[model samples]
Target: MAGSTDVAKVYERFISLVREVHWLNRISDLLSWDQQVMMPPKGVSARSEQYAVLSGLAHDRLAGNEMADLLAHLEAHSDELDEDQRVNVREVRRSHDRARKVPRELIQEIVTTEGLSQKHWLEAKQKDDFSIFAPWLEKMVALKRRVADAIGYEKTPYDPLLDEFEPHTTSEEVAGVLEGLKPALVELVRRIESSSIRPRREILERSFPIAKQEEFGAWIVRLMGFDFEAGRIDRSPHPFCSGANGDVRITTRYKEDYIPASLFGLMHETGHGLYDQGLDPKHEGTPRGFTVSLGVHESQSRLWENLVGRSMHFWRFAFPFLQAF
Candidate 1:
């Protein structure tokens, strides 16, 4: 028997709670970025603890009774809310329902283990020793399987894991799509290998100084419309885009002998950065401002890297800059 005013108040309270959770996530993202980009090698253990504490706090805040009560009240009054409010309520409910199923300690442990695993992964990659990372990988797989079980799935255990990124999709659906595309993709690759026409691959194999590559890549990324005031690029072992709103950051790794590694990687990440910067700031801290899924998120990066960055028309304007570099 709640009136419109009560529902509005509950909606605002719900948003306030979710906003704090969102801020916690952003802080966690910053910590993770530091862990990957700037943390000293020995700092992994401490960073893992920090991640665990933060994960537990955020999970508790999201899954607490107040949040549950607010969601129930808001959901009951769904017809009274506007489209955007309803969307936010619905998205939060989905996340809350799933999160409530998993223990906060489990989430904390998973994040803590993840930080250690990342450190081990870097070591394994550098030393070319799988043994360094294999145990951690096994632990992570087991942890994630436990999470999938808690979330509940109809078919494969991977379905819940896939739903984490894709939402409303199943492994079977993804497998069927991939199965359909594999033949065509294989045929395309076969045709490319058999065709006699080939470009000079050695042109990209020239000695491109790392400093010059970074300079050139940043210039191109700026030209691609990533606002410098809002975003910047740096170096990481693997290229990625992180942060959002007024402070997006991207990273790329350079190889002195291979130009495309950093160049195209920066372009790919810049595409993601641009998308991050483009989200509506008014809806910040809410699902309405976020990208829908990983697939759609990746599409932006691939589109820029493959469709636009690789096009001859783009090369027509960009080749001069490259030659100058």
Candidate 2:
């Protein structure tokens, strides 16, 4: 009984430390979210520095010797934990190992570069000129290549980078999936193009007041099970979902003349918002509380965007509300 109690105590302590790391990451995410959705254009430099410093601090904590010892102890006594505890320890250890491989300075550099690159991307997009962003994009790619090398890959440099967002996945596996899918997708597109049946496309292109669209988008996402009390929607140049459990946020851009742009975008981002808001609060600030991977995350958004939002059944139900607008 005493041995079991000691193990439990050790597990709790490890979890507490993991929670600290989670909080730091959450703060970093909020800073990024603000940079995209709310920060002033002139605030870019200061925000970039803040992002880099927070990123470095988080990396230091995750890769520190204290975390190393705790993870090693938890791994050695993993059998003593329940399934959830065991999984948390396993994931934290994996993250620790990966973080330890890359230098803190490199992590800071990557974060800073990402902030600057995004600013450049926004400018390039506004001007509709790739040349304006080419240099920054090239620099980011090189930095990422360095990151991939630092992390070490068995087959290709891309594998390590892909693994960051999609654990246990390899570039080759993704390529195989895409290769298998391409033929079917191409055939489906061809069939659609050749079909005699056609639907009116003019309705979707009709003018929609931005304010009304915002109201309609809010209503639609509510129907999709997005908790407004725990989440909010805003506008950005591009649509994205951010934040974690209990504070999820989504943003979408509205075109005054295009109804589908903000409407469908809201649906898509709401799908991601639902996933974030639905996470187990008890496991908040832990790996188990997070979505598994970007692919899985994207699946939720696409499912809502395509399988539900774009479906005939949904349009049948939505047409009335849309007409009222």
Alpha-carbon lDDT, every model = 0.91, 0.88
lDDT of 1 by residue, 1-325 (tens): 4599899999999998889888888888988889889999899999999998888888987888889999999989998899999999999888898899999989999999999899889989999999999999999999999999999988899998898899899999999999999999999999999999898889789999999999999999989999999988988999999998899989999999999999999999998998999999999999888778889889999999999988999999999989998
lDDT of 2 by residue, 171-265 (tens): 99999999999999999999999999897888888888999999999989999999989989999889999888889989999998997899889
Candidate 2 residue 230 Cα shift, in angstroms, is 0.5
Error of 1 at 163 (Å): 0.9
Model 1, which residues run further than 4 Å from truth? none
Clashes of 1: 0
What's the residue-level lDDT of 138 in candidate 2? 88
Query: What RMSD does each model have against the real structure?
Result: 1.3, 1.4
Predict model 2's lDDT versus the native. Answer: 0.88
> TM-score of predicted model 2?
0.96
